[model samples]
Target chain A: MARTDPDISPAPPATERGRRTRRKLLDAATIEFGERGFHEASIASITRRAGVALGSFYTYFGSKEAIFRDLVRDLSEGVRQAAAQSLAERELDALETERAALAAFLAFAREHKEIYRIIDESEFVDPESYRLHYEKTAERILGRLRAGAAAGQLRGDLDEAHAWAIMGMNVFLGLRYAVWSKGEEDRPEHAAQAAATILSEGIGPSDA
Target chain B: MARTDPDISPAPPATERGRRTRRKLLDAATIEFGERGFHEASIASITRRAGVALGSFYTYFGSKEAIFRDLVRDLSEGVRQAAAQSLAERELDALETERAALAAFLAFAREHKEIYRIIDESEFVDPESYRLHYEKTAERILGRLRAGAAAGQLRGDLDEAHAWAIMGMNVFLGLRYAVWSKGEEDRPEHAAQAAATILSEGIGPSDA
Candidate 1:
C-alpha cells in the first residue's frame, strides 16, 4: 500500500527496518532458546545468532523476557492460523478432524521446532508464559470443538476449556517426532493416524 | 531378602551405606534439577542443597549426567508402576476406566515433579533419552492395548507399533498439565473423559 514514484518515493520507512530487525531477532531467539533453554540463552548469543548486534537486540526488544513474550504470542498466532487454514480445507468427520488437526500440528512443529522448544523451556523461567501458550492453543481448539459440537459432530460431554489440553497433548506429540525420533520412525501420516485412532478410541475403556 | 540378620542388625553394611548415599544424591539431584534445571545446577550446589560434603557427592554419583539418567529411568518405572496399579483397580465402564488411568498419571506426576523435570530436560542433552523414555512407555501401553484388543475392548484398526507415539502424546499431556498448567488446571479427570470420547468416537471419518 505504499505509493512509490520516481520523484516522490516514500522514504522507505524506518519502522519497516525495525520490524525486519525485530523479526530476525525473534527467529534467532527461537533457535538459541531452543538450543540453550530460556534462562541459559544470553542476549549476546541471541544477537550473535541473529547477526543483528547486541545494541540492535536491545533496540528491538526490552529484555529476554520481552522476546519470550513476543515469541509466545507469535507461536500462538501461528498455530491458530495453521489450524484455521487446515480446517478450512475440508469438512471432516470426528475421526478425520483429529487426523487433520494432528497433521496440521505436526506440520507446524516441523517448521517451528525452535518455537516449540522455547515454549517448553519457558516453563522453567516463567510459568505464566507457559500457561499463556497453552491457554491460547486451548482457545483455538476449543473454538473448533464448539463449532463441531454445535454442528453435531462432537460429543455433548466435551469440556470446551479442555479442548486445548487435548490438542496440546497431540501438539506435544510432534515434539517427540521432532526431537527424539530421528529419521528412523514411521512417517508423519502414520503418526497422525495413530493419534487420530487414540483420540477416537479411549486407551482404557472405549466401547468403540 | 538380604543374607544379613534383619532381626538384630547393628551397622547396615558398607554396600548399604553406598546405596543410601546414592539414593540421597539422586533425591537431591531431582530437587536441584527440578528447581534450577540441569545446566544451572552444579555438583557443589546439589551437595549443599542435600547437606552433604563434596567428597561424598562424587562417591555416589560420578557426575550429574549419571544422576539424571538414573532419575529418568526411576521416574519412568514409577509412572508405569502407578499406571499398572490403577489398571489393576478397575473393571469400570469406559469413562471410569479412562478416568482411573488419568488419575494414576496425575498422581505419579504430582509425586515426581522433580523426576519429571529431569526427564523433560534430558531430551535436550542426548535426544536418544527422549526416545528411550518413549519406547519404554510405549511398550507397556501397547502391551495393555493389545491385551484390551484381545479382550474385545479396543478397536481393530489400531496399530501396535505406534503405541510409542500414543504414549508419547499422553505423557506430554500429563506433563503439560503438571508443568504448563502449573497445578491450577485439573485436566486429569477431564483428560480421561476427552480421551474416552476420542476412543469411542474416533477422530476419523464417522459413519454418520
Candidate 2:
C-alpha cells in the first residue's frame, strides 16, 4: 500500500507476497524492538514473532538497520498523512486546526507506540534513520504552516521555517505526553489544548 | 567522577587519575556514539579511540550501557542547570525570557551534540530514561509558568496540570530541533515569541 504523506514515501514491498511478508516483519519488529531495545532485540525473535523463515527476513532487508530505516520511513509517512488528513477535515479556525493536528499526533502515537519508540531509539543506533524521521516531520509541518499563512489564519511576518518551530514544540508535547509518559498520569487532550493556546497566544499579553 | 558545571553543580572525574582516564573515555564515546551508530560502535573501538585499555573501559563503567547512562545523565543535568542559570541571570522580559531559553538550548546542543544525540536516542532504548528526561524538563518549564502565573503574567485559570500540558510541547520541540536541524533554523527564541503570542491571546481577536 502507498503512504499518503508527501515528504516521505513508503518503499512498499515489490509483490503481494513481499508486501504481506514485509508488513509482518515490520509489525513484528516494531513490537519486538519496543519491548526489547535494539541491542537486546534479535532478528531470530522478530522472525519467530512474524512467523516467517529467518531467511525471508534477510531476503527483504539487508540488516536490522535496513528494516528500521524502512520502519521510520513508514511511520514518518503515516504521521504526515495523518496530519494532512486531520488538517483537511478541520474548519479553518486556529483553535480547531491546532486541535485537529495534535489529535492526529496523539492518535498516531497511541496506535504506534512501538514504532515511535523504534524511531526514537534509532536516532542513536542510526542517525540516518533519525534524520529521515525529522525531515519528514519538519517538511509536513512546514507545508501546513505555509497553508495556514496563506489562509491568513496563522501570523504573518514569520516564515514557514519558523512555523515549523512551533509545530515541533506542539507535536513534541504530544510525543512526550503520549509516548514518553506511559502508565504515568497524562492528560493528552488538555496538553493538546495548552499547546494550541501557546501556538495561538505567544505567552505575552495581547497588547505586547 | 562527577560533572560539575561551574555555573551549576554538575560533573567532572572522581580522582585526578580517574578524571584524566574518564575524560578520554567520555570524550571518545561522544564522538564514537554520536558520529557512528551505537550498534556499529564497539567498546574495542571506543577504547582504541580513547587510547585506554579495553579493560579500563570496564573500570569507568560496567558496560557500554552504563557509560551511555552517565553521558545522558550529565548532559540532562547540564541542560537543566544551563537553562536555569540563563533564567536567573536577568529579569528577562517575557519575549526576552523565551529568547534566553531558546539560546540556552542551542548552546547546549552545540557544545554537547553527542550528549544531546544520545539522550534523544535514549528514548527508544530505555523509555524510563526518556521519562526521567521529560520530568526534569517539565519541572523547569512548569516552574517558570507557575511563577509567571503567580505574578499575573500567565492565565491563572489554567491549573498546574494544564501548565504541564504547555510544557510538553516545548520539550518535544527542543529534542527534535536539537537532534536534527543545523544552525539556527529551528529558532526556539523566535518560535517562543510566536508561541507565547497564542498561549496568551485567544485564538479569536478578543475573548482571550
Candidate 3:
C-alpha cells in the first residue's frame, strides 16, 4: 500500500501476517531505541531484535528515521488508548474521570518505563513529533475540562492553561511515582489520589 | 586556583578578568548548545561565539562535557536565584509566593529561551545533573510547602508529591506561555494568574 500521510506510518501492512510482522518490528524498535537512543539505534539491530530479515525492514519502513517517527506516534496513540480504555469502563464525573485517566497513565508508564525515555528523547531527535504529542494531549484534556464545565462539575472559567497545568501534574506524577518509585507503597493509585485531590481542591487551607 | 569539588566547576578563577572570560564562555555555550544541541556543539564554536581563544576554554572547563554539565548546574542555579529574588521582594502568603515565583520564572524563560532546551537535553547528555536539578528543586519547593503549612497558609497535609505537582505546573506553564507562545495576549502574568487560581481554588465547582 502506498500511504501518503507523512504523519502516520508509511503504508501500513495489508495482510494479517504483514501486520504481525510490522508489529513485531515496532515492538523491537521500541526496545532498541529505548536502550540505545536514536543516534546509536540501528535498523539492523532492530531487525535482529525483531527476528526479521534485514532486507524486509524496507517493506514496512522507509528508513530508520521513518520507523522512529512512527514509533513515537505509536506510543502517543498507546497513551490515548490506555486512557480511553479506562474512561470507557465507567461513567465517572469529571474529577473522577481525570483521576482514572491519571491512574491508567501511571500504570502504563510503570509497565513501559521506556515510554518516558522515548518520548523525552523525541524532543531532541524529532521536535515535531514531540510537540505534537503534547499539543494533542493538551487538546484532549482541554476538551474534557470543557465537557466538565458544561456538566457543571468543574469551574466554568477553566481554559487551556488549566488543561496544561493538569497535564503537567500528571506527567510529573508519573515520572516520580511510576518511573522512579523506590517503594511498594508508592503506587499509581496513591499518585492518582494526590493529583485528584489537587484537582478537586487547591492545596490551600480548607477554609481559605 | 584548584577547586576540590568535582560537582562544581573545574577551578575557581583567581582574577576578575578570568572570571569575566569564564562567564562569557558559559554564555556562549548556552547559545551554541541551545541552538546546535549537545553532540553537535563544539568547544571551537563556543569559543568563536564567546570571542575567546580555544585554549582559554580549558582554563575554565576541562572538556565539552564538563562545560555542559556546569552549564546545566548554572541554569538550575539561575532558576533558583530567580525564584529567590522574586520571593524576597515581598511578604506574600504561600500562594502568592508561588505566583510570584512562577511569574519571575516565566519572565526569565522569556528572556532566556534557551533554558528549556539546555535543561531538557541534559537528560541524555548528563543524566546525573538532570536528576539533581529536579531533586534539588523539588526539595526546595517541599521546604516551602512545609513552611506554608506551618504558617497556616496551605493545607496541613501537603507532602513531597504536592511539591512535584507545583513544579510540574510551573515548568509546563513556562513551556507553553513563555517558550511556545504565538500571540501577545499569552503573557506571563496571565499564566501566573491561572496557576495561582488553580493553586488557590483548583478547577472544581466554586461551591465545592
Candidate 4:
C-alpha cells in the first residue's frame, strides 16, 4: 500500500538480500519495541537481535522515530493482509466474510500478542501512524459494507459509523479473547461466532 | 466504587475544604497529565495549576505515580457517573439505555477531548489502572445486559462477549465521533443511535 513516507524512510530494498535484512530488522523491532517501549528501545538492540550489522540500519530506516513509524504502518498492513487473505480463501456472503475476517484477525493477534502493545504504544510514539491505521481500516470496512448493501445481503443504510463500530468490536474482542485469553474457553472461533451473530441477528429477543 | 489503591493513596479528605482542595488537585492533574503526559508532568506543576501549596500534594497522594493512578481512577469515575446520570434521567428500555449511555459518553469525550490520550497513555504509565478501567467498564456493561435479559428485553444468550463487543463499539465511536469530531454532522446522538441500532436489530437486510 506504499504506507511508508518517502521523506522519513529510505526506499524499499531492491535486492533479495537487502529485503531479507530489512524484514529481519522489523521482526527484531517488533520484539524490541514491544518489550522495552519506544523510549527504552535502541537501534543497537534491534540490529543485534536481527543479527545484522549496525551500519545497515540506515540502509532502510533513517532513525529510531522513522523505524517506529514504519513499524506501525507495517503492522497495519499485516492486519489488512490477514483479512484480505481470509476473504480470498472462499466465496462468502457479507456476514460470513466479516466472520471469517475476524477469525483470521483473532488468530493473527494470538500469534503476535505484542501487536496490541505496539499499536497502542503508537498513539504516543507516532500519532499520525496510529490515526492512519484506524482511518484506513475503517475505510476498508466501509467499502465492504457498501458492497454488501449493493448485493442486498446487508442493510443499505450502513455507513462510516457502522464500520467503526464493527472495527471496535473486533479489536476489543481480539484483546479479550486473544491477547488476554485465559484458556481454551476463549477460543478465537468462538469469539468470532459471537461477533458474527451480533451482526447477523443482534442480541435482541429472537421472537421480537 | 473505591477505585484507589489505599496503600498508594492517602485517606479521603475529612472536611469540605480538604475535599475541595483534593478535587482541585485532581482536576489540575487531569490537564497537566493530559497535556504534558505522565513523564513530563510534575507535582509542582500540578500544584501550581491547581493553585495549591506544593507541600499539600503529599496530603492527598504519595508521589507522582500515585496521583497518576488516582487521576486515571477519577476519570474512570467520571465516565461511570456520566452513564449513571443519563440512565437515571428517565427509565429506558434496554436498547434505549445503551443509546443514552453512549450519547452521554460522547458528550463527555467531546468536553474532555484529552481523555483519550490520558486513558490510552495509562497503558504505559500505570498498566494496572488501564486494565482496571476497561475491566470495570465492561463489567458495568455486562451488568446492564444481564438486567436487560432478566427483564426479558434482550436475548437470553447474551454474555460477557456481548458486553465487551458493545463496550468496544462505544469506545471507538467516542474516539471517532467525539474526541476527533470535526463538526456538526458528527453529532453524539447520531452516533449513539447508530450503535443502538446494532444492538436493537442486526444490520441484516430488513426484509430478511
Winning candidate number (DockQ) = 4
Error of 3 at A76 (Å): 0.4
- Alpha carbon lDDT at B60, candidate 1: 53
The DockQ of predicted model 3 stands at 0.79
Off by over 4 Å in 1: A1-14, A35-54, A90-97, A160-165, A178-185, A200-208, B1-14, B40-53, B88-100, B160-165, B176-187, B202-208
Model 2, span A3-78: residue lDDT tens: 3332233455689998899889988988888898778888899999999999877667767767766777777778
Q: Write the per-residue lDDT of candidate 4 for residues B42-149, one digit (tens) a residue.
A: 999999999999999989998899988888999999999999998999989988888898998998998888789999999998999999999999999999999999
TM-scores for all candidates: the values are 0.77, 0.77, 0.96, 0.96
Separately for all candidates shown, the number of backbone clashes (residues 3 or more apart, or on different chains) is: 12, 24, 0, 0
Model 2 segments more than 4 A misplaced: A1-18, A39-44, A53-63, A88-90, A181-185, A205-208, B1-29, B36-64, B93-95, B124-127, B157-208
What is each candidate's DockQ, to 2 decimals?
0.23, 0.35, 0.79, 0.81
> What's the lDDT for residue A164 in model 4?
93
How would you order the candidates by lDDT, starting with the best? 4, 3, 2, 1
State the displacement of the C-alpha of residue B113, model 4, in Å, after optimal TM-score superposition.
Answer: 1.5
The candidate with the higher lDDT, 3 or 4, is 4
Query: Candidate 4 chain A — worst ten consecutive residues by lDDT sum?
Result: A1-10
**Order by DockQ, highest first:** 4, 3, 2, 1
The residue-by-residue lDDT of candidate 3 on A1-208, one tens digit each, is 6655433455788899999999999999999999999999999999999999999988898888889989999999999999999999979999999999999899999888889999999999889999999999999999999999999999999988988888998999989998889898777777788788888888899887
